[model samples]
Target: MPVIEVDGLVKRYRDVTAVDDVSLHVEQGQIYALLGLNGAGKTTLIRMLLGMITPTAGSVSVLGAAVTAGARSAWARTGYLVEAPVAYPELTVRENLELVRRLRRLPGGTDEVIERLALAPYAERRARTLSLGNLQRLALAKALIHAPDLLILDEPVNGLDPAGVVEIRTLLAGLAHQHGTTVLLSSHLLAEVARLATRIGILHHGRLLAEQHADQLDQHRRRHLHLGTRDDTAAERVLQAHGYHPHPAPGGGLQLTDEHALARPDQVATVLVQAGVPPTRLLTEEEDLEAYFLRIVGADHG
Candidate 1:
């Protein structure tokens, strides 16, 4: 069975609909990422999944159990980092984790997690004194302290620097690949998610616009052949004569979306050179994830 499941989920706040008819599933050991802009209901959907908020319509199931308020069993095997990390201002890092250990009745000491998250240096430091990056790490440590079977994170790397971001990514990937832990995370960082997530779901205007396997992203990406020559008009004319439609690119080059042209850029170079317009630049460009995301969202709004 899928580790996480949402069926026709909907949430309404008075007259405003926050999420509408959304449904998705996450299997064990898979990293599923939800991408969207601010105010796109990503947080609201996550809240419903964690049973923090009741959905107006639809159902959520985690670990083969229905998600509802006070579903202790379901929550016991789950770990989450939602929004900003919060800690008692006066509590030291180690003390905060110790508190979580006792509250969750977890059967382990805080030493392992402290080392795992590289918090030993600041273990005795007060939460109030930690930097934003360390505070984010503390939140992650809390979520991972119990070694839960599932993790649901919202912008887990928000306050992290480049190295910190890479560290957390490796940790999450290890958990999923080595331990079969399922992860569902939301992030606005398209490139980061593209690197870590096995699948990606795009949300917009409080709705799911698209969902696709991350590995298949390249296949769905639009590819174009870029050609440049000393004589732009001649190159364009040559392409047209060969029944290929060319468009002007922003960088004073010609772009062709024809499948045959994209497939055989070498042929394009040959044609251009044979026409005495020897190509100055000939390359095939595949749209990156960020560009693809913007294109998709733009089309949705258009």
Candidate 2:
């Protein structure tokens, strides 16, 4: 069985469906990320996975055990962080981790985790006094203090600085690749997810719209030729005269998606240069994960 299995999982609130007919599987050592914007039901689906909220329909299984309201078997084997990080405001960072360790009956690993997450500096500092970034690190520390088999995080990089983001990314990657950990996370950070997740699932409007391997993502995103010249108006006309259709890009440039234009951008540049417009910048640019995500979700909404 996969490390995590979500079969036809769904949730609803009155007349509104928060999640709809979503099914997915995560195997050992694979980092699977759910990609969606806020209000896309990513949080609701995650809540169901952890059995924090009962599903309106469908089912969820973790570590080969069915998730139930009272089921605690898989609870000890999983680490998760949903939405904002919380801690006992009166407790020191070390004390908070100790609390988790004692509650979890773990032998010992607090010191290692503190260093691992670069939390050593704040280990003795009270949670209430920690900065937003440090507070987030503490939340992650508690989750990892148990060293559970599966780690589920929502917006894991929230409130983190650039260096902190890189640290967490490296930590997750090392856990998956080296320690055989199965990680399931949700994020709207498209580029970061592209760099990290082994597989990605797109959720929008309470539905799972698409799934693909990260390595194969490039082939799926749209590719276009972008042209920037001294005179965009003349550049657009010149491209059109050369049997190419040009559309205004979001960044005030011309975007051409014709097979000919993409296949031979140099030729298009030649045309633009000869036409007195003179190409300032010309390159074939493929849609990044963010663009692809917006395109897919926008198409669904439209």
Candidate 3:
């Protein structure tokens, strides 16, 4: 059974429809990423899933339990960090986590998560003294203190540096792979999400435009062969004679999107060289997550 499920979920605020008939499911041990631009309703959808807000239509289920406001049973096994991290100004890092533990009725324990999130160095420091990155780490520590089965995070890496980003990425991967924790997160970081998530869902204008496996992302994106030769005219002729449809690249090079040509670039090089117009450069380029995202969004708008 799926770990989290949403069916025909919709959220409306007066005249604006924040979420429009959205539906998705996250399986156990899967890192599901919801990607979107600003005002794409990602946060709204997450709020509904967490039972922070009631959906205008449809329903949400987590761990086989329906999500409703003030429902503590379903939330016991869930951890979340929404928008920005906040902490008591006067409390130390350890004190903050200890307070959360008590509130959750969890047994006495704050050291494990402090070490897990690399917050031990600042354990005695006041929350107000922590940097943005360390503050994020502290929030994550709270989420993980209970060792919850599912995690829902929004912009979890907002204040993290490069190294911190990688650290959290590895941590999340380990959680899903080794501990069978299901994760559902929303972020504008497309490339980062591409690297970490097992499945991806694209949201635009309050609607889910596409959903696909991370491994299959490249398959859905465009790829092309870029070729540069000493003699452009001769190279074009050579390519035409070989029945390859080549188009002019932005920088006066020839480009071909034919799958056969991309797969057999060496053959194209041989053909060009034999024709006395040896290629100066031959390479294959595939669209990255950002470009793929723009293309999809543009196509939808067009």
Would you list the C-alpha lDDT of every candidate in the order shown? 0.93, 0.91, 0.92
Pairs with steric clashes in candidate 3: none
Cα deviation at 77, candidate 2, in Å, is: 1.5
- Pick the lDDT winner: 1
Cα TM-score per model? 0.96, 0.89, 0.95
Please say which candidate is ahead in lDDT: 2 or 3. Answer: 3
In candidate 3, what are the lDDT values of residues 1-302, reduced to their tens digit?
A: 89999999999999999999999999999999999988899999999989999999998999999898777787889999988898998999999999999999998689889988989999999999999999999999988989999999998998999999999999999999999999999998889999999999999888999999999898998999998987888899989999899989987899999878988999999888888999999999988778899787674344
- For residues 1-302, could you state the per-residue lDDT of candidate 1 as single tens digits? 99999999999999999999999999999999999988788999999999999999999999999998788678889999999898888999999999999999988689999999989999999999999999999999999999999999999999999999999999999999999999999998889999999999999878899999999888888999888889999889998998899999987899999989988888888888889999898888888877888887885344
lDDT for model 3, please.
Answer: 0.92
Question: Which candidate ranks first by TM-score, i.e. highest?
Answer: 1
Q: Give the root-mean-square deviation of each candidate in angstroms.
A: 1.5, 2.8, 1.9
Report the lDDT tens digits of candidate 2 across residue range 138-204: 9988888888899999999999999999999999999999999999999988899998999999999
Weakest 10 consecutive residues, lDDT, candidate 1? 293-302
Candidate 3 to truth, TM = 0.95
